[model samples]
Target: MTLTHTSTGVLEFESLRDLLRGYAGSPLGMGRIQHLAPSLDRDWIEQQQQLTNEIREFRRVGGRFEFAGLLDISKLVDEACIAGAALETTQIRDLIMVVDRAAEWREIVMTPPAAMKNWSAVPNISEGIADFTAFLREFRNKIQPDGTLEDRASPELARIRREIDKQKRTIQESLRGYLRRLAEGGTLQDELVTIRGERFVIPVKVEQKRRVPGVVHGSSSSGQTVFVEPIETIEQNNDLVRLLDEEQAEVHRILLEMTRRIGENAEAIRNAADVLAELELQFAKARFAEDYSCVPVSLSPARDAASGAD
Candidate 1:
């Protein structure tokens, strides 16, 4: 008879599953533990036992195996597969991590330690994995670890960012004299420079806003101080905004091209994830078995298995 939900709880099987989940390294591995069911099939039981035993041995020999840092990129891959899509920095970073992990997997799985060489439980997963070498190299060349594109990502992007930086330094220098001028006029509410609606502005007394030729952005909460962008900095701020817009366009273009590259191997990526998840699940099972002093038991042909395990 199949174990019902109530029976599972009473038998402490539910709690056992919860304990097993703690041994898993990733969401995918934990999901496998969560969906586990009691099985009576002799072959299936034997396979599970053998795979767990292999992993225990694999670890005993100082061989490392886990899915610790692997992320669930299936959703991202789905979005990347869309035509003409442009992924943001975080999304691209996730993809890069996956590709890098795949590269590591290729090396380890293909040439395992002599102790694990005869084990068929962990087979070569390279065929299921896609060749992301070109993509990985290109992404590394174009992107930084901090979610920013390198200056060489594109000529126009680099040029625009450079100009933006130069203009910002100029604005900072100019603000000093401008703030001093306003502070001297008794029109300044605070001797500071701040941004309002993306333009640099100074806080001036409400009545003094007309003291200088400037645009009124907003006012402080008390409404006593109004933020005004002096007429002198308007042309400079406008240039900065224009350069920013160009940088955004270039970033968008690069992202779309990268997304298209990801889409080209979307199917293979999913398959590779499945292969990794299965390996992780087996290792999790091994660790769980070790912690709980558990062993797989095969039922007799007459279905009269040892009463103790049940």
Candidate 2:
């Protein structure tokens, strides 16, 4: 079937598309709205109308549906297909969110209101959804919303972070003690311990730099004070830095593993994404109908003839 739109018809479709876009919950959904057009296939139009009618009835009975994290991950998925490619923490998190939202939507449709159950029986609506959801569970506790690996992401990471924390506390305590001694001796420029260039240091009077017997990292503007990393705490600081580096490496490994797992399921993930996008478009159309009190208009023979002439 051939479908053609005149200038006026195109304008009207654009206006409707804009209205539907407003109801879309994700980028994928909005893109679908932007490409939406009147279909010449009678079956396709009838199916769309039926879906919208079902959604309207579901909404009227206080049914609530929310879709989140529908960002397009096609680029990331494409990247994942490359050899030895790893997704960043945030990218993996976003993918997980997409899978999670898809699962939620499927569950809702599978258990629709009794009055709408038959309408919800769209063939293969939940296909591959469960597998994608199960795959995402591996990352549930591993990744944080901010795209950082959680301490619980791996036992090695937890251990490294714990050691890092211990070393930090030890360094802080030793630095405090040194600060107290310098203050007592009246050689300290400031009573506070601060960090300069990632090294914990104390400010000491410039003339008393010899008394501190440490590395002079920086000097104050007036040259009256110098930031010194005391020799006594140098070992602890080194250990802390080493532990921090190890923590970072462990987090990277975890992210790599997560991304590899996602890559393994790339096809399934893509399918799930397509299903979720389709559901979002249907829901947007249903919501547009609800908000605008829209009913499907059948073209009578006369109207059809008139449209043909135009």
Candidate 3:
């Protein structure tokens, strides 16, 4: 049957969409709700009800599922249509998280509890997705949850981080010695060695600026003190900066590698994302039915009659 805004009253559909929105777990599912309409096709409605009934049975058996990393990645995938397209580190990480969740959900579906074993309508959505977990394993250890490559993501990254740490320690030691000397000479304004523009510096009295013999990065509001990066540690600071650059380059290489790997498995990843979204949508409808103690759409005589008349 054909159901339009006029026949159903736009407000009625809007209200139901609003209710569905509350139960939707992800942007994909929530977005689909606005397009929902009553259907008179008995077979399609029965299929939906069968799935919902299976979900209800699973829930009655104390089965539960939680979805994660539901960020809509369709745009990112579409953008990757180019031959050499690259994704940002955060986007790559998000894609990895979605694949990981899909694999986990696939496992749950494959090995349902005793109560769900006989439920024929249970959707095996992850079937035929070839080795999603193994493909994603290439990134599992490389990227951290905060969207930064781990220092141990590769041997080069680990080596660069170690050198950076050593350089930092050397700089800190030199700065501390300078601080001690300045304190002994009564030229120091404060005992703290702070950071300025990514370089370690100490605050010194304006009168003692020449005594410190370093680059004056800035000064206090009253011009009573200057922040100085002592000359003694200048070379060490430069080394540290160089190592930091190397670290950044290494991170970029790792992220690029991840993006490339994603590109290789892009189609499977997109398919997995679609499956998860559909699962989320179906589960959301089941949850809404459970929460409101309402009948499934297929079994609602009033809705069936209204749509059948058209």
What is the C-alpha lDDT profile of model 3 across 84-165, one tens digit per residue?
A: 5667778877777778878877787778888777766555445634467678667767777787778768999999999988
Counting only residues 3 or more apart in sequence or on different chains, how many pairs clash (N, Cα, C under 3 Å) in candidate 2? 0
> For residues 1-310, what per-residue lDDT tens digits would candidate 2 score against the true structure?
5357685385687787787789998897787677777766776776777666766677788887677557888888888777677789889888888878877767776777776666743434656565455676688888888988888899999999888878877888998887887788899888988888767889999988899887889899998989999999888778877887898788878877887888888887888888777777878877777777778878443345566674
Candidate 1 residues lying further than 4 Å off, grouped into runs, are 1-13, 38-43, 124-127, 141-146, 150-152, 296-310
| Candidate 3 Cα misplacement greater than 4 A, ranges | 35-37, 80-85, 128-130, 297-310
| Model 2, CA-based lDDT | 0.78
RMSD of each: 4.4, 3.5, 3.7
Q: Candidate 1, residues 1-310: lDDT per residue as tens digits?
A: 3477777778898787787788888876676677787654667777777877888888889888557767777898999888888888778887777667776776776788898889775563346776667767777778777878888988888888999999888877788798887777687888988888778888889998878787889999998999888888899999888888888888989889988888887887778776666677788888777777877775666644576575
lDDT of each: 0.79, 0.78, 0.77
Candidate 2 segments exceeding 4 Å error: 5-11, 120-124, 205-210, 219-225, 299-310
2 versus 3: better TM-score goes to:
3
lDDT of 1 at 280: 75
Candidate 2 C-alpha error for residue 5, in Å: 6.0
TM-score for model 1? 0.84
